[model samples]
Target: MTSTVLTFAVSALTFVLVSLTPGDAARAVLGRDATPEQYRQLRAQLGLDEPLAVQYWHWLVRAVHGDLGTALSTGQPVLRTLEQRLGPSLSLITGALVVSALLGVGLGVLSAVRGGAVGRALDLLSMLGLALPSFWLGLVLVAAFAVALPIFPASGYVPLTDSPWEWLRSLALPVLTLGIGGSATIAKQTRDAMLDEMGRDYIVLLRARGLPERSIVLRHALKNAAVPVVTVLGLLFVGLLSGSVLAETVYVVPGLGSTAVTATQAHDIPLIQGVALCFTVIVITVNLLVELLYGRLDPRSRG
Candidate 1:
């Protein structure tokens, strides 16, 4: 019920905001120097001449039936446009999540287990990761790896079907750009959780029972600490979705983020609304999945 309300609210708000932005959809499509008659005809055909409430009502009806309308610029169905762009975005997001989880969990566990200089170093690195902007970091990576070293392509995506290896190579920099900050957050959370779990009486009981230190830390303490870390990961997924905009733009990834920029530039309301709606759905779905996962990890959360 809550999810349904949020979905409707976000969709309605997106529609209102996009409608309020100053631009004539017909004029944007027809361009300057179009005859007044041509503009009027196009406006009527596109239903732009109708009252705002009427326009929204019409759109809402069609959207309920899964018709997102046509993009003013491309004349293509918005759902089709989104389908074409969703793949690259998902690839970028999935790759970044993997990178963050492995790096963050590894660094965090190591820091907690071997405190002192290592822990301090991890702290400094996390701070740097959080401080640096993804786009700026992307540029630095491009210069070093793509320009200076010529190890990876600077900006562009390769379809996985064409060559799986090349596709992964292309996404490398963008993934790193989005993942670095996420890793920092996860690392901090994991470290704190691990520290707290290790200090608990249960951990002392396990040690007294002659459990191996490594087993106690990895199997017992880490499991108990996972609830919080998992929560951070769920939030990170949403952040990564938004952060992909900058990463995609910097790397020319041809994802929904880039398409959204193009749509906004051309005042493509249907396309813009479609993108916004798609993102909202994805975020809400991810959050729900996270909640389920959280309940699984910590059964107490189910209550």
Candidate 2:
């Protein structure tokens, strides 16, 4: 209940901030010859002339009933636009997160177990990944896969319902960009958490009791280490909420990030507010779920 209200408050705040940016669709559509009188008229016509409090109240009421209002740029409903573009963006992020979780946790396990040359290499790689920007990484992946190898499309989106192969082809580079960056962040967190778990006296006692190494690490270490891993994941997801803007732009995927860029460029208040609110809600909801998962994943976390 707290989180639900929290989400609403944060999302409401996002609406106000995006709506406050200077200019509007009228300014973008009309030249400077667009007089102050003309601007006021246009704002009134769009109902954008209202005070922020009034605008926010009406928007909040409408959004609760699923009417997200219309984009100022195209005068199209925001929900309709989101529906068309959400699938590819969601698919890309979901696939990347899954793959990253597996590889990252696996590498982290190895790093915790070996503590040798392999561990050093994994740690080093994680650091590099942490430093690397996703947009730059996307460009590099495109150059390699599309430019040189010609294996994947350099940019574009394909609907999953249209063709599975097309979807995969279009999603590969964006996935790699996200996965590489995400996994690196997760790997470091996992490595550190696992290392801490292994140092616990119970783990030492388990080793003394002749528990199989695999059972000890997988069953014991991982279960205990998961809380922190989940924390990092929540943080990473928050990062992804905003970071995806560049990734989406680079890949030409019609996600909210691209929508945001267009909305901002065109000074489309409705679209901008809608996207910001949706993204904030998503990130907050993800974090809330992670919090619940921690209560389940780590028994001691309840304390």
Candidate 3:
């Protein structure tokens, strides 16, 4: 029920915001030299002459039926365009997510267990990760890995169907760029959670017993600390989606991020709304999964 409300609200807000932006669909399609008569006709044809409320109502109705309308720029269905672009974006996002989770959790555990210099270093790195712009980092990575060392392609995506190895190679830099910040964030959260868990009464009890230090930290403390860590990871998923725009643009990956940039540049309202709606849905779905995982990890959450 909450998810439904959020989805509806996000869709409506996206439409309203896009509608409020400068320029209309007709002008975007007709160009600057179009005469008054042509502009009027185009406006009528595209229903841009209608009230904003009526326009939103009509769009909402169609969207409910899976018809996201046509892109003013390409004259193709918005859903079709999204489908064509979603694969690359998903690949990039998935790779980044995996990289962030592994790196973040590992660093976090290490820092929490072995404090002192390691913890301070993680704090500094996390600050840098959060401060650095994804696009700037992407550029640095490209220069070092692609230009200086010539280890990977600087731009462009290769479909996994064509060559899985090439696809992974192409995504490697963008993933690192997008994932690094998220990993830093998760590492901080995991470290805090681990520290808290380590200081709990149960931890002392386990230490007092004959349990191995490795088993206590990994099997018990880590498991107990997982809920909050999972929550941070879920939130980071949304950040990753937003950051993909910069990462994809810098890397020239033919993904939804690039498509979104193109749509916004052309004032493609339908395409923009479609992309926003897709992102909102993805975020909500990931959060829901996180909640379910939370319940699984801590049965108390099920209540």
For each candidate in the order shown, give its overall lDDT on alpha carbons: 0.90, 0.84, 0.89
Output the lDDT of residue 221, model 1.
Answer: 93
Predicted candidate 1 versus true structure: per-residue lDDT over 117-147, tens digit per residue: 9899988888788898887888899999999
- Give the CA lDDT, 0 to 100, for residue 66 in model 2: 85
All candidates in order of TM-score, best leading: 1, 3, 2
Estimate the TM-score of every prediction: 0.96, 0.90, 0.95
lDDT of 1: 0.90
Candidate 2 segments whose C-alpha is farther than 4 A from its true place: 30-41
User: Could you give candidate 3's per-residue lDDT for residues 25-95 as a string of tens digits?
Assistant: 78877889999999999888888889988988988899999899999889999999999899999999988
By lDDT, the candidates rank as: 1, 3, 2
RMSD (Cα, Å) for all candidates, in order, is: 1.2, 2.3, 1.5
Which residue pairs show backbone clashes in model 2?
none
Candidate closer to the true structure by TM-score (higher is better), 2 or 3: 3
* Worst window of 10 by summed lDDT in candidate 3: 21-30
